[model samples]
Target: MNDKHFDKIKNNDGFIAALDQSGGSTPKALAAYGVPETAYSNDDEMFKLVHDMRTRIITSPAFSSEKILGAILFEQTMDREIEGKYTGDYLADKGVVPFLKVDKGLAEKENGVQMMKPIHDLDETLRRANERHIFGTKMRSVIHEPNEEGIKAVVDQQFDIAKRIIEAGLVPIIEPEVDINSSDKEKCEDMLKEEILKHLNELSSDQLVMLKLTIPTKANLYKELIEHPNVVRVVALSGGYSRDEANEKLKENDGLIASFSRALASDLHADQSDAEFNQSLQKAVDSIHDASVNKK
Candidate 1:
């Protein structure tokens, strides 16, 4: 969060509206919430996870359906992968935009060019984001054991995909996922900045509007975020992040969206019930809601 980007994004309201949160609310959270841990074990586990999450997404106070456009529609990503949850038309009816994540898994061929097909189902995804005015394509650049070539490839392919997604009309939420593979915090931050610059060089400034990252919670990380600008509206991931981290990211700015998943489902890691997951999500949701109110 460099000062330049922070101020840049903070200056734009439309950019803030571009945030799309499609993560968290797991079946594990459900079990811990009190639906009985058994609900998630048998043949019915997947079904229950889906059903409970959907119901809670619309009804729960934790979920700000009113403020946010539902995620891109899908079972896995509707929460994480951008499932939108609602059908494209349904989203339109509610006056809420849809967001799609375009990822073509990864390369499988041993000697093939390792290109990811984010816009794999191009025609359909284009129709969804464009015709529907879906917010944009929030890209994921995975840094899993990534060497220089791998990192560059991930950045290159994903950015190229971002270019296409924007040309198609949706905005781009460039997410360079930083995890264990990213090594240390300095490396993680540097790589992320590099990827953004690379992406900007190709996509230019006008076509992009979002920065979706799961920033780390270390104190230095906090200082690092303080230095960034809000070039794109910010949205922090739900899990793998701490409140301190989010506060640092959003304090320099506002109008950002944060996913309320893992943090909400903490106990669920131990494996709880549907009721438990709901409760976790509920708490997570409330935390965000409260933050929003405070921001007001």
Candidate 2:
């Protein structure tokens, strides 16, 4: 695992864990699974979670590999109250980077106009980045079926958002999730790609970090990006589905999947045991990996 191949993981495919609350639990979990960093969304529990994860991500057996435990922190999902100074102090001493999901989130209505509100205050986000100066973030750069104005909006926002986040010293992963639940797979494929190319074409080297693609079976074509000409980092989407659906997506490359409600929510819907649940999920990914290799 010299530095060269380690660089292949720039964003393409490798395991990424969504550690919603149990960041501390990832060291053992990742080691046992033979995966990469486990991510946590900085929410009400971040102080406890980040503290635990930052410690283990460094000491974990995989540290030499440079794949630390990571998380997706959106002010909405993580915590809106975490200010810049507080985050900076915490992350710097821990010596780990976090992926902030930078969404202004929904706007707060004021007067007759809507006031833009980021999930966590960008001021705080910048503060956190400045403190340790090595954090990562994911920004939503595009959406589905956009009209001319919509496409323009995507391109315009990337430039503005990236500029601010970079000033704060954070790595940004761009997520332009195209809707995947289309009535027909073929139409969905064409639209998905057209939308992807549009935003990608507009991205400046500094504005776009990693391209996050939706890996649901909108059509198997959606899965083709696993080999798409564009080598941006791709993350799987929920697709308004179940855990089985998400694990199925992981089949492409065990290293390139994101587990959301589908992964953890299985416990809520099924009577399966922990071991049984994992085995079933592993089996799906194994099958997908085999197929992906065979296709090549």
Against the true structure, what is each candidate's TM-score? 0.61, 0.53
Clash tally, candidates in order: 49, 13
Root-mean-square deviation per candidate: 7.5, 9.4
Task: Report the Cα lDDT for residue 212, model 1.
Answer: 63
Q: Cα lDDT of all candidates, in order?
A: 0.48, 0.43
Candidate 1 weakest lDDT stretch, 10 residues: 12-21
Give lDDT for model 2.
0.43
153: Cα error in model 1, Å: 1.6
Q: lDDT by residue for model 2 over 111-165, one digit each (tens)?
A: 2212223445666755654443335666553344434445445545554565576
Model 1 TM-score on a 0 to 1 scale: 0.61
Off by more than 4 A, model 2:
1-13, 19-69, 74-97, 107-120, 132-134, 140-148, 182-189, 195-199, 202-208, 216-232, 250-256, 259-265, 268-296
